[model samples]
Target: MNPDMSAGSHNGISMVAEGGYQVAILPADGKQLTLYPSLQIDRAYYWTFEAKADNPGDKIYTSLWGDRGAKTIPLTSEWQQYSSMGTPNPNYQYFYFWSVAAKGNVYLRNIKLYDAQDLDIVVEKEWR
Candidate 1:
């Protein structure tokens, strides 16, 4: 597994948590995925972060930060799944995770990236 996924600057953010935190598989450096072309005003795109909560009964959520603003997608306590999508601008370049019930530990399986329209899947990139 890679340290960083296809994300942007984690400036004050992190992937580590004691009893309750973002619970992400963060990068050694704050900077994660930096798209080549960046985002456009109207170009639609989608990003996905897949994981299984250590406690299947725990609640988790997905968050994204872009030029527009911050968006949060809710998650269930089931051992199933979660995802989100949008047409973000190129200006913003950071994402955050929210834990509804992050009491114990959580394991992030994979954080993926992709094209918006066809939804082509892109593997999570390392911070190198």
Candidate 2:
């Protein structure tokens, strides 16, 4: 977490009993949580994760490689899986999830970035 963007006592990340983590980003203007993952240039990958907000209709903004790939994801109160596929921009190396004008806690689990070619094998193993 960046000190400048920190929400003081209003934001936190904690481990959940079942699995994964709970990330709380309180309602505020310009508060963002960023995650940087090592990615191979020019490789197509599948980005997948399960997430749910504390309340129905909460929204989260996600950006890949700065603003080159941006998406507005609407979240529900119940856990749901989200996924996207693309090659990372060679110029930037970042993935971000932020609260621009929304509030509430968001639970995230099984966050994965897998090679597009290997995704089927990974999914098969998970189902077995």
Residue pairs in clash, model 1: 7-33
Q: Summarize candidate 2's per-residue lDDT along 63-114 as a digit string, tens digits.
A: 5665644666778888787765566778876565665455676655555666
Best by TM-score: 2
For candidate 2, report its TM-score: 0.65
Candidate topping lDDT: 2
List TM-score per model, in order.
0.49, 0.65
Model 1 weakest lDDT span, ten residues long: 26-35
Q: What's the C-alpha lDDT at position 78 in model 2?
A: 85
Off by over 4 Å in 1: 1-37, 66-81, 89-91, 120-128
